[model samples]
Target: MGFPVIRNRRLRGSAAVRNLVRETQLTVHDLIYPLFAVPGTGIKHEIPSMPGVFHLSLDLLDAELDEIVKLGIQGVLLFGVPEHKDETGTSACHDHGIVQEATRHIKKRYPQLLVIADTCLCQFTSHGHCGVVKFNDALQQAEVANDESLELLAETAVSQARAGADIIAPSNMMDGFVHAIRTALDEAGYTHVPIMSYSVKYASAFYGPFRDAAHSAPQFGDRRTYQMDPANAREALREAEADVIEGADFLMVKPALAYMDIIRTLKEHFDLPVVAYNVSAEYSMVKAAAANGWINEKSIVLEMLTGMKRAGADIILTYFAKDVARWLRDTE
Candidate 1:
């Protein structure tokens, strides 16, 4: 029908009508908050690059966790900033590691809250790369040892599962990471825990604030060696396919705002749940614009997240999870 014959304005005539005809509805249940956990007695230092997001100590988590639970956020993706770093990231797999201890504590207190441990070695490695590094004699520079790194990743995943993590999210971008972690989890009798692989993480400029927040900036080289290039869309599918074949329960695309196409592509191709990480720089940009009175933070955030949902994201891991939950509650 033509526009005059079937006027679209009729449906848009009223807010109630618009609400009734809304194609996508974003809810608190679709949100997963990302949290930073550092080892200490009492500390809640906010990252300068990412405002309103704090690097919390284990003792300070009660208040944050309580607020999250009250706001009805389903889960949190946890990253640990250890005080110690080594070549192999041995601290990451220790029984009393920062993340392992934090996992145990959170599960003990809030059994209902899902804790997803980020299984990676960047923050625990002295070199600040995601994996073990070796001097490539031919290349005349250090390169990440992919196969050797898988053992540490597997150990980290099993350790997290043992510490009561509900999910293991590997963000290292290593080849066969999902397979290694899955095998390790099954062998350790943690087959129930699922792997949320960062299958299509791109080497983009959007991770500056996150590196500050997690204290995981590469000391010498960039992550382009392992992380996917942002220019190629077809490569995303192949990356996701590998993880799916390796038994990843959820496939994730990092820095979601610019890569909504990738999110929809994965959703269309994959049968599993597709998660979009609304990354640090995305959040920081909004905050910066809002601070200058250039935009309405609440409305912009709602619209942005809605757009993500409309793009076919089943779940979103975002720094704005708590705020979004509150906004939803207040409106209700």
Candidate 2:
């Protein structure tokens, strides 16, 4: 044989050696658990499409937080399912709203846990859109009113902060939304609370399960007018840039698996921490396949999470947070 001096197989010869050469590491601290808060006591209903995820009511939240704390997960992102919905999503701004109430309860019980409130009107809006809608008679269509939505978004952020949220995450992809929210937080004496902007959210089909969880499917048109197109990489950068300039403390890319390139791009372009949302659809697919015996759930999940970290995600907002954390603890 010719001189085969470079033996790449040497590093792959042993499991311990492979692990030693691992390029990325996934840990409990890199996770941000995403929880759904609904209205009721003693209620923990599993989302049908998302196997292990549940919509938890505040009455049972203390025990749930106890379990979460035991898993060594330090952060949580909350999405609220309010009892009521309206044209302007006024309920989202109420200090007594589901998210606000949940925030207060969670923070009071687990003062050390970092609570991030998802600031958006979709879950509270009657039309299930992210912003205020107006019918355009000239075009014979309904569209999100960008400027009108800014005030409501700001109000919602302030309410979340008052209710003890450590961070306000605005997923509503409205123009100038982050700037409005940052100013609102500061003016409301919550300058310490940070804004985690969903800066590169795409108008993706990977949000079906989330709609079921939050009851946020738009009754009319799609969100393409606001959300970025999956085909466009440059637009993602533009969106992230705008949010950064608008004072976003952290930037997030939604439906993380399909947007790993976007995540990498943002991490390379920005100095701030990059968050990736391993969205409900992504979770559901894995769960469904695992339940059907199509894949080894644990192994695949670890691989997927490690891939996200390798792609430069500083934080991962995932439905598998609790399970993954437990698995890590047990394995370790």
Candidate 3:
């Protein structure tokens, strides 16, 4: 037990020794790739900000899904970009909605693939807010209608479930969203579908690339009212607790790099599978730096993913899923 006799370098002597004594492991099963779904056939448009990501139409999307299955990526988080948007985000809950149609297609073709529908109104709402918005005359700006948004959020969850989404991931951060959606899913005969709640989303600047990819930037205001403040860690626990009490099957912490502590906190306190969202801005930063030759992409990415695992994340929603999968394969 003394310092000289118990030198820790014994386990760090070689690669095989280090591997055998590794406390964390990152695998393909822990990754959930985020994909963009747009309307139109045979189209695969690249997102300008998020370099490697693309907006794939269903036809083009099918081919990618096939590759994803072959690569052994376990799940996908889908964000649909509709041709039209409205004040109420009607497209989000329509029978033939973009996400709904995409869900149906994946289930019919890749029935074994785990499809998690991004159940939020931002991409479909004309105002581009995550929920229904109403102009508040007193505040001199538009304000998201929280209670009213819950009704539509619940409807969206039910619609995605009906379309064969195995998991409904509600990322709006609206009050009572989990409970409302849980009730809606049960009433719609989708009790088997699980809810993956964005329980600890924060109002952070790290989502710019994602907003560009999803086309969900608010036209007028910010999401600070509903999303948690970035400075508060204790509040994340409160939010996670509420989602769990409301029947959320999984809890998520967004912008995972800067929030690893939050991920560990939630994992330590909750029994549900804690998920970490390796956000778009985080991805873009790495890509930008790597492109500039400031760092090594493979090593940094693997370390980042492994760090999340070491931080206690059971799953990670990341843009690096495919790259990480290929990298992991190369080492073996």
Candidate 4:
């Protein structure tokens, strides 16, 4: 099949031909929208760094949910901004916690919609670390207590499951987190609940907009101790392997745009569904360029997301979900 004899351009000659030969497809059903729920009566505050993304209150979720349902978006990943934070992140596992309340509310109204609760303590902890922090005598500074934090992470998973979250997504990046959360969920009589693990989260600068949106930036130190280093690719496989062994139902790579290779690698090596997180910074950059008229937002987003799917992401968690859904529908 030489190029001249093959005449590949024949397939690209028309929209009909292109459609027939298209190897990858992007659809509304592939999207998982991320929503932020804060504790308040009336609030729909737009995140400054991440334009168009709002911090919605429980009372205000109806509009968002209605739109999501209408858009044919299948799932929503939730993050909570509690009214209060503490050393232990007590609110993270409370029955009346912001995320729990939002989950219950969403399920009560839209029972069919998949609600995934983000099981992490960063937004709930006063120090903004994902886990419990303690003074390390050896390191001579306060450090995240991984083993101690596992209990809270497990408790958080159970709490979310109890609150009617369809899935528990643990983004803490702690060792054995999937095993801990899985054990806790099963023990709490939620054996059917699945764990979506952030298997290869990197401590990268690409998360600044997310930290701003979630208000989860560390107060004293960075998350390099727990989050994977950006320099290593093999480490991603080991991380995913551990989560797989620990019973993670889905493995996700955060900040997806720059990590498409990792996404492809995981899909090639793992049987479980691989998810790609089109993180805040990645979203904001496109929004910024689009706002400045430097790029066509729809074309760029469509191309980028299609590339992710082509890279073998089974599902994508993205802020652009709503727009992408609408775009796909309009095109159809």
Candidate 5:
């Protein structure tokens, strides 16, 4: 009944004891790897900011998929950087776009792998804004046009669905995105495909490395206009309500490390599966610290991932998925 009588250390005593009493366990099945696809052959350029991640071309993507299969990673989130970008991000909806090509190839090679296409226009837009931008001449400012962006998002979603994308993740954070994309997918005979909405994504600084990996950084203004403000908690729930009402199959909280509270909030409030994106900046920091001998990379990474799982994340999209999978296998 007392602290001395009930020894908590008994559960934390050793590996076996700790394993038996572990409240959260992160497995390869719960991990989703993010892969960048560029338009080229035999290309696997390492992202400078993200140490172990690469910008893989379609030709080279299969080899990476081979290793992911071996590691038992069940899901992969793919982002495409096309050779051509435009005002409306036309490349994103192209019939033979980079992501479409890569998705077709990936599904051909690994039929069972859950390949998720990141449906957004930042990388494909020359202006590098998530949505359609219009200048407010009187106000001396540019604003993202939410309604116009929805049409483009719908086009992009349908195209990805056509290319064998098992899941379409709309990360643009535009209003009515889930509804538009869902309607488009259904009209295009992809009603079976699911939508993974980046329901509670915030305009956080933890996305620095991801912009580099996806080539999606804005040329001028930041994403504060479209992405949720980092200071708001109640707004995230409102966003979730909209997405859920629009029929989002999976709800996600981006930049998971600093927003575990938001993750828990969404998980508690929604019946849909909750996804936590351990964004690139978070991964890069751990890699940098581990490289400098400041921390044990394996132990820290496991702890961080387990923390997300404990916070009610059903799946985590991280750059460290491959490494974590290998670590999990070896430790077993």
Candidate 6:
């Protein structure tokens, strides 16, 4: 007979010993709820792809906020589905736009809750692109005009801040967008408004459900031209560096599950807080699999989120925010 000299299972023999030696911890404070707002009264339409999530109108927001706040979630990220669409996405910058109104309502009613507004034009543009597009005569193709798009993105950020957004999250991926929005916000006397830049958002297939929820899929070419390539890791660092230099208060890596390496890289390289978006498609996939009885839903959900935290995500923008918070509370 033989005996092992160092039995690793000794540490796992009890819950107390395991808790004391745990490397990463996930908590309610680490979550930021992503909310979709539409225009209307009494509208709480659930996105079919995302079973438990909803596109709530302003009239029904109170109940939603009440539930979120009661769950101990301190922050929310808002995406607006404007009623009107145009070539320039004019409604996106209007003070009365869906997101603006939602921000104001959320702030007024839940004064302590932090509201992060998604400052982008896709949901408001007729073409469903993140920026303004122009046709190139020589190439006979449409190209996103970077400088012009920056101008509109700045306007959108300022508009969101004026509408009472505590943080302005620019997810458009336009070059110099963070700098442009920072300058615009400061000039407009919103100097205190922080920029949560989507610094390393990839042109990922994991964004499909989000486009359905926000109604922001591009009409023609894909966002690959602007968003980072999933194949590159160094490029993510460069993107994060650019946003940091441009005055981003927080750096975000989108589609957290697939890009945890990027999230960890950004956190290790940058001094600012790192945020990871546990985006819609990621949530939907888990939900679908769990509904099919193929996996242990709750355990997997907690493990996925804890892995993100362990990978260096300081804040997580997740569709599972409320549910995770409730689960954590119940287990505690």
Q: Per-residue lDDT of 98-207 in model 4, one digit per residue for the tens?
A: 99999999999999999999999999999999999999898799988899999999998898999999999999988889999999999999999998899999988899
Comparing 2 with 4 on TM-score, the higher-scoring candidate is: 4
**144-248: candidate 5 lDDT, tens digit per residue:** 999999999999899999989999999999889999999999999999999999999999999898888888889888998889899999999999999999999
200 Cα displacement, candidate 6 (Å): 0.2
Q: How do all models score by TM-score?
A: 0.98, 0.97, 0.98, 0.98, 0.97, 0.97
- Pairs with backbone N, CA or C atoms under 3 Å apart (clashes), candidate 3: none
**Reference-based TM-score, model 6:** 0.97
Q: Give per-residue CA lDDT, model 3, range 1-332, as digits (tens).
A: 66566678889999999999999999999999998998998888889998889999998887889889999997899889999999999889998998999889988989999999999999999889998888889978788999999999998888888889999999999999999999999998998999999999999999999999999999887899899899999999999999999999999999799999999999999999999999999999999999999999999999999999999999999999999999888888
Q: Model 4 compared with the native: what TM-score? A: 0.98
lDDT of 6: 0.93
Residue runs of model 1 more than 4 Å from their true location after superposition: 1-3
Q: Which lDDT values do the candidates have, in the order given?
A: 0.94, 0.93, 0.93, 0.94, 0.92, 0.93
Pick the winner on TM-score between candidates 3 and 4: 4
| lDDT, residue 294, model 2 | 100
Tens digits of per-residue lDDT, candidate 1, 216-274, equal: 99999799989988998999999999999999999999979999999999999989999
- Please state the error at residue 177 of candidate 2 in Å: 0.7
lDDT of 2: 0.93
Question: How far is 58's C-alpha from truth in model 5 (Å)?
Answer: 1.4
